[model samples]
Target chain A: QQQVKQSPQSLIVQKGGISIINCAYENTAFDYFPWYQQFPGKGPALLIAIRPDVSEKKEGRFTISFNKSAKQFSLHIMDSQPGDSATYFCAASKFNTGKLIFGQGTTLQVKP
Target chain B: EPEVTQTPSHQVTQMGQEVILRCVPISNHLYFYWYRQILGQKVEFLVSFYNNEISEKSEIFDDQFSVERPDGSNFTLKIRSTKLEDSAMYFCASIGASTDTQYFGPGTRLTVL
Candidate 1:
């Protein structure tokens, strides 16, 4: 079973537009949600993270809006740029579990 | 910034051969983990190690697989007999004492023929 589900396998947005990716998880034990960005032939890098305690967290131009009761979270990129074109993965994990359950992934393309 | 380092960016091994992948985690990190990603697939967790012992592992980690912290800084994963299905990109990650964020290595592309 896929523990976490992501929507819009691919996305395209114009520069200065907002790009969004959403993910949902079935396990309530998940307390930490993180978004990772991966470029071709490279490892995934941490983009932003949020705990269940907060409904929203923002870092730079990236923001994570989490709804604990709905078991859903979404990543929003403001003013999307061509450099933002990459694959994004949303992950969930229980505290101290040491392992993350990752979503299928979303490929984003920012057209200049 | 300190980052995890993995050896041999790519390895091509024959079937039924034993292969060991090595990783050197950050100096102050306490948790180490191994994950794999098949082509165009989501990253899958293999195992997690802490304090020289395994803290968690996934179902995909079978008897043919084993992990060891041979020294203070080196963590290794061994596959007793590799199969064609083992071909994938293996990534090593480490987390420090203060944060839950994991820093990942560039990954070693293992090709089992």
Candidate 2:
């Protein structure tokens, strides 16, 4: 029930294109969802997050669309750039426990 | 901006040896956690600490693993006997009063041979 499944395993996009990654969870107990971006040999950095309370959230060029009833959420990177090329992870956790269950990261490669 | 810090960017130990990974969480953050990721795998939660005690732990935490907040600032994960499978990137995370947002530190790469 703690699983947060994400897809596709790998993504390729051209510059100035929109890149979208989707995730779904089986655990309804999860009230907090966050997306992380990680470069090679570094830790995951917070990208953007959304909760069940809101359907969508936008942070600069990154946006998160959440569907509470469907137990689904997605991260969209607008005007994808080579700098945005990295492993993106979708995580779910309960507010009280704060133990994040991460998805099988999606590696995004934005071609120059 | 305050962030979590970890020591010994890399550690190499022989099988059966003991290893400890240390972390200094963000000041004023009340909750701390430990997680691990094997090469090319998803990050897995090991444990969570609060108020100088373990608030929660995962099955992977097992008897060989332990956590401590010896001082007010440093949080540590100790593996009494390192196994070959224990080699992974261990991460420390913290959540402040918000109870939702968690900040992760640059992980300690443990290589058990």
Candidate 3:
């Protein structure tokens, strides 16, 4: 079973526009939610992470808006640039499992 | 910033052959893990190692798979008699503690023919 589901297999946004990707999870036990960015021929890197205690976390132009009750979270990129074009994955994990359950992934292309 | 390092960025082997993938976690990390991703698929957990032994492993990790920390700095994954299905990009990750965020290495892509 896919515990986490992500929408928009691919997305396109103009430079300086807003880029949004949504994800929903079935496991409420998940306390940690992290988003990873991966470029071609490279490993996935941690971009931003959030805990259940916080509803939102902002890092530079990247922001993660979390909703614990809805079991949903979204990543918002303000002022999207061509450099932001890459594959994004959202993952969730609990304290005990320590194993991350990842979403299918979203390929975002920010056009300049 | 401490980062994980993996050797042989790419490996190509014939079916029924043995392959060993190596990784070196951050110097101060204690928890180690292995994960793999088939082309266009989400990363799947293979196993977790701690205290010189396996703490957890996924169902996909079968008897043909083995993990060993041969030295103080290197962790290796050995697959005996690899099959074509074994082809994937293998990633090694480590964390300072069990609850800390994991740092991933530039995965090793294995191609089995």
Candidate 1: RMSD to truth? 1.0
DockQ of all candidate complexes: 0.86, 0.85, 0.72
> Which CAPRI quality tier does the interface of model 3 achieve?
medium
Best by DockQ: 1
Query: For residues A1-112, could you state the per-residue lDDT of candidate 3 as single tens digits?
Result: 4389998899999999999999999977888899999998888899999999999999999999999898899999999999999999999988565688889899999998
> Which segments of candidate 3 are over 4 A away from where they belong?
none
Q: Check candidate 2 and list the clashing pairs.
A: none
Q: Sort candidate 1 into its docking category.
A: high
Residue range B1-113, candidate 3, lDDT tens digits: 77899988999999999999999999978888899999999888899998999999999899999999999999999999999999999999988864458788999999999
The lDDT of each candidate is 0.94, 0.94, 0.92
Question: For candidate 2, lDDT tens digit of each residue in B1-113?
Answer: 99899988999999999999999999999999999999998989999999989999999999999999999899999999999999999999998996578999999999999
lDDT of 2 by residue, A1-112 (tens): 9899999999999999999999999999999999999888788889988889999999999999999999999999999999999999999998888889999999999999
* Residue B5, model 3, lDDT: 95
Record all residue pairs in model 1 with backbone atoms less than 3 Å apart, i.e. clashing. none
TM-score of 1: 0.98
Relative to the true structure, candidate 3 reaches a TM of 0.96
Q: Candidates sorted by lDDT, descending order?
A: 2, 1, 3
Residue A64, model 3: lDDT of: 99
> Scoring model 2 with DockQ, what do you get?
0.85
Per-residue lDDT, model 1, residue A66, is 96
